[model samples]
Target chain A: MTEDELGGRLAATAEAAVQRLAAALGAAPLAGETARPARLLAAMRHGVLGGGKRLRPALVVETARLFGRDIDDGHGDILLAAAALECVHCYSLVHDDLPAMDDDDIRRGQPTVHRAFDEATAILAGDALLTLAFDLLADPAGEPDAAIRIRLVTRLARAAGMGGMVGGQMLDLAAEGRFDAPAAPMGEAEVRSLQAMKTGALLRFAVDAGAMLGRASGADAAWLARYGDLVGLAFQLADDLLDATADAATVGKATGKDAGRGKATLVALHGVEAARRRLDDLVAEAEAVLQPFGERADALVAIARFIAARPS
Target chain B: MTEDELGGRLAATAEAAVQRLAAALGAAPLAGETARPARLLAAMRHGVLGGGKRLRPALVVETARLFGRDIDDGHGDILLAAAALECVHCYSLVHDDLPAMDDDDIRRGQPTVHRAFDEATAILAGDALLTLAFDLLADPAGEPDAAIRIRLVTRLARAAGMGGMVGGQMLDLAAEGRFDAPAAPMGEAEVRSLQAMKTGALLRFAVDAGAMLGRASGADAAWLARYGDLVGLAFQLADDLLDATADAATVGKATGKDAGRGKATLVALHGVEAARRRLDDLVAEAEAVLQPFGERADALVAIARFIAARPS
Candidate 1:
């Protein structure tokens, strides 16, 4: 298949995977009947299922494919892991938009959860989603080996926890305006570090997790990890550039607002042109790492390009 | 050995297991490099290692003992699982004490994490701990079959997520004060339902997870689960009684405060005498379930008695 056709196919697969996950999660039995907590459940579902590009899940499927495994070989575990990642991502967005954090009202072209619900509900929903992510991985469907399942769960935890996403967020919060002061402008090193922790960690997890589900080992696993990291970095740089250059309507969220908020960004540090160039470099690096896999790497290559070239 | 002696031995083992787990987690390569967010690591440690009774870990070790498994079985997956349970337990406590949740200022006689750090930091710490719990299980620590590890992770997730602790908390929040209002007066049934979801779920998870670690199945697993449920309910009722009757200094935090806060409690719903009688009945019922296991069940029975009779 042509690269675009392959990319379209993978995206379709990811979409179906997410829909299946939602259905599966819905069918899970409640502990008992204690009035359902309708509002909390609604907020949790909204935060999780609100539309976005299923990049993380896509990476998982593509990486598994590259490792010579079809979707059916522990696809349930992969989808559950993907669903969990989405939960963390959604929770972060919800919390980020809170008054204590970024204080914005719009997210994905709709009122943020805190705006739709209250701050408490938003916070609880975020907390619930974060916990629910672990829950999803802990009890993946189709019953993979318990030991392997544990490994996948651990990877997600480390990626999403202090040493990863939360760490990046803390640094971002601390480094806001200090980037452009008498000191360095958040520098390539610092920006890269932050992006690696925040975005790359989870993306890398998706790739590594997909490999785990397929039981990939040795060099194959290492290559997928490298691919995940490269794609993750490119993805973030593209995001930084989009925030600077895209209109809010096109981006499906507020844009150019990072500068207004004094948040550190690649565009702010290295300029839009430099950020775009850097994204190209990352994409190239990612593609190079996948060369040994020959045609099997096609999906990964297309994904890297799609990340760097995405309109928003 | 007598039941008390067996219980004492098991408690000591649980403590040693926890210490070993702390060392293992501390020595993890991933724990290094605070070059990102030092506070997150510190918060995680403080929240996790902060003092509390290691009830869940004890349940794991004792249940494994009952199943005739050693600590080193499956290369310490059992230990790792135990540690992971503590992390989840700690995370729940941290979040449960949050301003938006329980609004507590102190826990186990120390300033609650939210009071020590900012609310955001505490929230992030709890989130990190919760994620780390699953991570610990998924990573290959011992020689457990991958399938078994996955099952354990799934079980933990179910207990800790929406249908378990989260569900119970929501019920408690919604049912506050209404338990004793003119309409309902929250009877034994409601209290049992709440305790089942809250305390019983995690305790049951602890036993089942330990059994999974030991590769126990069939009737043995069912008995352990039933034993766990009974013990868990007894533990909660004892807690409710202590809240009503113990001094704050002795309890190590606030006691008799639930009533003042208009929170539902067994004492509030059924009165102190009835609550005490119920505790006795629970202990007797729990012992009856253990009657089939003979000496192997002694430690569990002793633990149940301890829960019923603890002064604090």
Candidate 2:
């Protein structure tokens, strides 16, 4: 796909996901909710509805669209699932930007949740958004099958929880050094492992969750998972490169902080040229994994390239 | 049940829940985890394994024991489920203790998670603990039935998410006043509403979840749910009373700060004598709701009264 076409496709998918998400967080309380606190709802909307690329949800939507079985009760069901993933992604951003964490003042051309609201609201908003991920997935309208809903919950909990994204974050902090501990020098292998858990896990699960929704055969699902793994690594590599090369305006957030923070990445280890080559190879491998799906996988192939070269 | 017998039962159940939780958070990584980051694992262990009454899990276990259905794959299954609820409860405490939130330095006579760990680690630890709740429930051994697991996830997402506990927290903060807004006056009804969402929801979910685990008949589930609601209300009311009457050492945390914090509670509205009378009524109503379970619910009854008259 051409750059413009890919951008258009991504934008369309993001718009759809946003609309679905707005409805999910609408005024009507879900069952068991006594009442929705207005301030909290506004903060949640601020954290989630604020503009971003929405790449994660697009991956989920595109992957599910590429696969078969028609398990979703409605077309919107897939979008709801995609939106759920975005909730997790957005919540991570909110918490990650807290003054106690990354301390970023801006995200996606807007003030970080803690900056826009208060620290407490940002924290609670992130918590609620994380909870909503499971809420959206397990809600009856989100999916038709109980088995699939539970599987999604399990997969998501693993990807986003202690063992996955959260654990990775802790490792990242440790590498940056604590008050008593000196910075830990991570070799390429250690850096890769840390990044895999921090960023790669959720991206991989996004694609894997889409496969579960589509009920793909075991072989097909396995291949898709492998493809997701490559895509995840490439996505992070590009992000590191973007941080190094792009200005804050271009990236729509603070840039050039990785070096200052002493964050270790392969891009930093191998130089920009090597990282560029790796991205190309990842896109190629990702496309190859989808070869068996034939021309039906074109959108996913485009998305893989897009993620690998996001800023461009 | 005498006070001594009740205390023994609660302590014994707390022991079992703690053991199950330790096993759940052991060194072995569950599925989809790359590896448990050592520092993160320690922080999570601190937040969770640092003790409390374990009352929420006790409610789950006792309620499940009261019903009849052999759905759990292993006897430990119920304990696992109970531990899951405790994870949610403990996670809330961790986040709530953050400097930006409640700013609590002590819990259960130990330094709160944030006091022991850094702010970022405490935040991540709470996030991980919350994620583990779903992980333990959906794990193959957590429950054998996908349908039941999905139900639990949905129920939990509601009880713990924006519409429930998180929402309540937001409301609590809003009432405390933001930089731009003055503290909003909350009457008894509003206070009850806020407390129900903030604290009561999860407690109610504990008993309802136990009923779910045992696959109680709809009528039985309804009655059990009613008991949970009363218990939840009574539990919060007693907590407010404790905050008003107890010293920091006795409560094992900061106490008598609710009034200073401008936290609106019925205990504040009705005074101690009236609040005590209400607690008595709440316990009576709770026991009546469990009447259908006959002597099988004696332990739960005693537990409810204990909660209402805790710190005696």
Chain A TM-scores of all predicted models: 0.86, 0.92
lDDT of 1 by residue, B1-312 (tens): 665676578677667766855674465347322243766666677777776668788778777877677676555556777888888888888877877677899888888887877676777777777777766777676425776766676677668766677767766765653222432335668777777777788888888876776667778788777888888888888988877776444673444455444456777688789989988998888888878778787777888888788776
> Model 1 over residues A118-222: C-alpha lDDT tens digits?
666777677777877766666646325555666666677778877788777766765654222432346678778888887788888888887887778778888
Off by over 4 Å in 1: A1-11, A28-36, A67-78, A138-147, A177-187, A214-217, A244-269, A291-297, B1-11, B31-36, B70-77, B177-188, B215-217, B246-264
Error of 2 at A88 (Å): 0.6
What TM-score would each prediction reach against the true structure? 0.85, 0.94
Could you tell me which 10 consecutive residues in candidate 2 chain B have the lowest summed lDDT? Answer: B67-76
Candidate 2 Cα lDDT to native: 0.84
Question: Each model's C-alpha lDDT?
Answer: 0.72, 0.84
Name the docking class for model 2: high
Task: Tell me the tens digit of each residue's lDDT in model 2 across A44-120.
Answer: 99999988888888788778877653324464377777888899889999999999998999988889988888899
